[model samples]
Every structure is written in C-alpha cells, then in structure tokens.
Target chain A: METKNDGPKQEQRLTKKGKETRARIVAAAAKLMFERGVAGTTVEDVQREAKVSASQLYHYFQEKRELVHAVILFQTAQVLSAQEPLLSHLDSIDALWSWRDAIVSLQVERQCRGGCPIGSLASELADSEPVARAELASGFMKWELAIRGGLIAMHERGQLRGDAEPERLALALLTALQGGLLLTQVHRETSPLEVVLDAMLAHIGSFAQS
Target chain B: METKNDGPKQEQRLTKKGKETRARIVAAAAKLMFERGVAGTTVEDVQREAKVSASQLYHYFQEKRELVHAVILFQTAQVLSAQEPLLSHLDSIDALWSWRDAIVSLQVERQCRGGCPIGSLASELADSEPVARAELASGFMKWELAIRGGLIAMHERGQLRGDAEPERLALALLTALQGGLLLTQVHRETSPLEVVLDAMLAHIGSFAQS
Candidate 1:
C-alpha cells in the first residue's frame, strides 16, 4: 500500500474523480435542501440525487444531521466567499455603490429563491437545533463583520465623513439588503430588490466626495 | 334548553370574561409561537397552555391550522392597528420622531419578542402552505398599503417632498423594519432595532419639510 502522508491527505488521497464525486454529493444535497427545506431533506434523497451508494455517502459524512450541518456550513461559506472581494475593499462611497450593485445582481440573479439561504434556514428552524442555529448565526455574524470592517476602513481613510457611524451604517446596509431579499422572494421578481438597492445606493451615494 | 346562537353558546353574548379568555388564548399562541416557533407548536400544546378544553377552543377556532391563520390575522391587525392612528396622523417630521420612539419602546418593553408577527411567519411558511401563505401575504399587503397611503397623503400635503415615491418608500421602510426585527430576534435586544429605526428616520426625515 502507498505510504500515508503527514498531512490530512484530503487533497492527495482522494483521487481527482473522488473529489468530483464529493462535490457532486454536496451540490445535490444543497439543491435538495433548497427544494425540500432543511428539515424535509433526508440523506437517502441526497444519495439518490447524487447517485452515490449509501456506504459511500456515509463514508463521506457520518450522520444525516451532521451532513446537513456540513451542507449548511458549505453553503454559508460559499455565500460569504462570494462577497469577499467587494466587501473587503471599500475606500469611498463610490466603492460602496459598486459593491451594492454586485450584491443586487447576486440577489436578482437567483430570482429570490425562498429568500436568503442563510436567513431562510435561520427562520425555518430559528434556534430549534443547536448546531444548525449556531451555524446560521455564525454565517450572519460573519457577513455582518465583513461589512463592518469595510466601513471602518473607509472611515479611517477619510473617504467617509468623520462623523459617520460605521456600525450603524453597516447595520443599515444589512437591513436594506435583507429587506430587498425578502421583498424579492415574496414577489418572485427583481423589481423590488432593484428599487430597494437603487434607493439604498442613492441614499448612501449622497455622501460622495463630489 | 335556552335558545342557542351557534356552536357553543355563552351566558349572554361574549361576556367580558369570554372576550378576555379569547384574547388570552390568542396571546398564549403568539408567545409560544414566538418562542418554540409555529411549526413546533401544536393545538394540543396551545390547549394545554391556554387551559381551554378542546371543545371550547374549537368553538373559538375551527381547527389548529385555522387557529394559526386567525393568529396571523390577529397579530397582523394588532401590529397595523397600533400603528394606524400614529401613521395615519403623521404630517410632520417631529411626529414621525415621536412615532419612532413609541415603536422602539414597544419593542423594548416586550424584550424584542414583539417582532412583526406577520413577517416572521411569512418568512418561514409563506411559501410552504398555500392558504396560510395567501392569508399572510394579504395581511402584509394591507399593512404596507396603509403605510404607502399615509406617505402619499403626506407627500400630497407638501409635508414630504413631492418627488417622494411613497409606495416604494413604504415598501422599503417595511423591509427595513422586518430586517430590524430579525436582528432584534438574533441579538435578543432592541438596541439593534432602535439604531436601525433611527437611521431610517434620518433617511426619511431628510425629505420632510423642516
């Protein structure tokens, strides 16, 4: 047998094909969860959708709930990672407008499917399940922190007015985003999201250095 | 036997005691629902907690699902009716500020449990159940319309800027309110809501005649 490596071997041991299989399983689980809601989705459904054997799926994840938690974390990171670049760099109101556009486009592209994935999950179970709730809370907290850091940077760089309340600004931005997302989901259209995003940008852009 | 009105006849017609009992039952459902969530609550739990017999509860509500729908409407109306007088008479920025303080205190007094009862429920099961979902949608639509109408009147009266998009502004305000509610639920505090509301007032107040 080949010698075991000192590292996790997650990348090396799993063949390129096996890695693809694992990703496919996760994507399949995510799609199913999106359709059925977290509580309704079962491991068997994921396995069937992924076309993977029960043993193989179990080999990848020990328990169904654990796998769901993994899926949640996976999706949470995916959403947060998407905003990394836009949220990480914002030195001025113009930058905020550009970032807001990216956010609106991301939300609009999805056609508001069942609302924000993380918010939807949070509302679904609220704090019913400890692990899921923690994951959900962590996801939102992480997203909020990213925005807060961006605002702080902008404020420190003198791009934002010296009196701007960074924390309150971030909170307002988040609430506007959430409001846009919920309205979009309810109407199953992008108009509401677009309007809210535009108004938000207009409101924020009023502070531009012009 | 005395002539009866319908299902369960009372000693006269809805005595003060009877009305209080009904209100208590609805309040009990709302509290349990906000805590354990709607999906986790059952009629049996409501009956036990409300200390009302199944037959007595049925007299007030046809079934568990119907009871939830009634709760949704009652909660929606409760929220809207409370704001109606204030919003309806809102003709100046100072009045709006007073309204904001009242809202903040209302939410803080209840320990942040006084969320937009309709929004919380709509966020969860609005897409899951058709009938209940429609009822919730209608409830929200009515509440938003009321605000939109109020803003339109204000704009027409020159209290607000003529360019004010009353309808869109109203929707955005509702969305922000819901977002504030979500944050309040997460933080278990009203400060988040207060700050957001204050920021909202700042935004909206900018357009009001000084």
Candidate 2:
C-alpha cells in the first residue's frame, strides 16, 4: 500500500538504540492514533506519549506524515502477529472456526471498544492521504495473503473441493471480517460480527469436500 | 443503530426556503467532509464551500456536530435513494445481480474515488463522535432493514430453502458490501467489490431450493 519513498531514509539503517527509540515513537503514535484519529492526534502528543525529546522524535520522523507511515506498518505487524498462531494453522475448517472464536473473544475482552487498528486507519486515511493510503492498502494485501495462504493449504489438504477458489473465498472471508468489525465498532455489540462470520464460514463449509 | 436523541430538533419543520438553504449547507458539508474528514473540515470551510455567511450556517446547524448529524442523514438518504429502484425490486436472484452490476458500474464511473458516503463518515466519526456514531449506526440499520425486507420477500415466495435465515443473510450481505466498498475505496479497483459480492451472492444462492 505504501507507494511513496519510505521517507527520511534512516529506517533502513538504524543502530540498535536508534531502532529501539524509533519503535517506541511508533508504538506510542499507534496507540494515540487508534484512540484519536490521525487529524486529532498531534506530534506533541506522540512525543509526550513516547516520552522522547522533541529532537528524538524529529530524528526518526521528519514530519507527522512519516510517523503515520511507521504507525501503519506497526499496526499491521501487530495485527498479523496476534493472529499468526491461528492463521498459520488454518489448514482445516475447524481451525478457521477457532480463529473466528478467538477474534470474537478478543473483541469481548476489549468490550468491543476499538475496531481493527489497521482498518481504522484505512477508513480515515485511505482516500485523503495518498502515501498513507498506499501503505494501508499494502497492509490489507498482507492480511489477505495470510488468509489466502491458509485457504490454499486447506485446498492442498483436500479439506476443500477441487473447484473452490481459495483466492476469492479468502477475499470474501476478509471482507466479512472487515465489515463485521466496522458494524461491531458502531453497535458496540458482537452479534453483527458473529452473524457475518457465521455466514462467511457457512459459505466456506458449503465448499467442503463431502 | 442510532440510540441517541436526534438533537436540537426542528429538522422536520423548515419552510420551503429554509429547507432549501439547509439542504444546500448539508450537501456542501457532505462533499467537503467526504473529501476532507470531519476534523480536517472546519466551519469556515463549510461556510465558504456552501456560499453562505457564517451567521447563516450557524442559524441552521448551531455547531459543526449538528451539521455532521444532518450530513449523516443526508448521505443516508442519498445512498438509499440511489438504490431504491434496485433495492426495492430484489424479489428475484437476477434482480440482485443487476443491483451488483449497477453498483460496480457506479464505482467505475466515479473512478472509485469515494466509498459509501455513510460508511466513510462511520469510519471517521464512529468512535470519537458519539452522536454521529449513533446516527451512523442508525443509517446502517436502515440500510440493513431494506435489504432484510427484500430477503424476506424471497423467503415468502419460497425461492430460498426453509432453513434460510433472512435476518442473518441480510446482515451478511450488508457486511460483504461494506467490506467490499472499503477495499474498493482503498485499492481504487472494482475487483475487491466484485469478488466479495460474487462470493456473497453465490453463498445466498446455495440456500436456494431447486
């Protein structure tokens, strides 16, 4: 999704300390940005939240847009890392269901306060900020690829019918998840999400080898 | 979806001239808000864009939040109005596909520039703006109910299997459309929308009794 130059070039060649400091700024920005939108969150807020000096914040990020880019990447990695266990093992229908249950439980734990971090950014910035939009799009592609990989695995394991198109199915599954999360965030209830996921999974099951 | 009071009443009691002026403000605000998010769009921007004086803008809205509420309602009406012809006639499977094609064509016509008007607002304001979130939630509910109505018609006609749950299926269809719209907005491509809708519609067809 990120099409612009990585911006301020030092990200690729940071020293150990520099990397840690940069990561700290990004983590803090991600949290604040998630709670408040990009337009609402300021660089001063990120500096205070990260507890880094102004110079330190500037050292890593030349501008707020650059910092936003890092945060997008950070959120993407965080989301993927959280689901790695279930996503990597989605070689069977049951495994996929487990993944759905886990997602629902996690939402309950959060009291359904925040929607998908990456998705929230995509919604806010995708159209207005070209560079950030590219990064957000790439983040989604990564997520889609992960789901597609699992579906492909299911196909290879003979869990799904030979005619089942893993790419389209995975895309549909992700779409359901994204839509479900959006509704869940709005309603502060998990039922919308559950209904959508159930339907998506049921569709997936229809393709299960009989 | 909207659980809050509509706030600062009298949206229903405007004179013809008052109604036209208010509608102009709402339309201008919606366009600006869609292009630049809520936080990014200021009262001054709305006044300038709407070609109304500041006092005139305030006379109608009282605050930016009130304007946002109106815009939310305006967008809901705009979206529903556009789909009324197709959405109202979703009594057959072919009608639904025609609806999908019409949607895809509209997206291509816009060069996939803007996503769903209501969804765009929801993504930006749902978490931070409680009133707007409630309004957005209500907008989604209205959209969902419309879809559900059509599905119920199908079920009554015995087009779908006895086990088909219109409520859940309508929710799922709406979810797919929302997710598809979000992705389509980000990628600036119609494929994501097409893929997800095709998959969702196919799933619905699975519940069709031969």
- Residue runs of model 1 more than 4 Å from their true location after superposition: A1-29, A42-68, A106-108, A127-134, B1-32, B42-68, B82-85
The interface root-mean-square deviations, each candidate in sequence, come to 2.5, 1.1
| Model 2 regions lying over 4 Å from their true place | A1-9, B1-9
Give one clash count per candidate, in the order shown. 0, 6
Model 1: fraction of native contacts:
0.27
Clash list (residue pairs), candidate 2: A1-A134, A1-A135, A1-A138, A2-A134, A2-A135, B2-B138
Q: In candidate 1, which residue pairs clash? A: none
Q: Which ten residues in a row have the lowest lDDT in candidate 1 chain A?
A: A1-10
Candidate 2 per-residue lDDT over residues B1-210, each given as its tens digit: 333345324656778888788889989999999988888899999999989999999989898888888888888889999987998777778988998999999999988878888887888887788878888888898888888888899999899989999998888888888888888888889888898889888888888875
lDDT score for candidate 1 against the true structure: 0.70
Please provide, for model 1 over A19-125, each residue's C-alpha lDDT reduced to its tens digit, 9 standing for 90 to 100: 78777888898877766677667899999999999999887777876666666766777778887687777656767778777877776677555777766666655
- Would you estimate the TM-scores of all the predictions? 0.77, 0.95
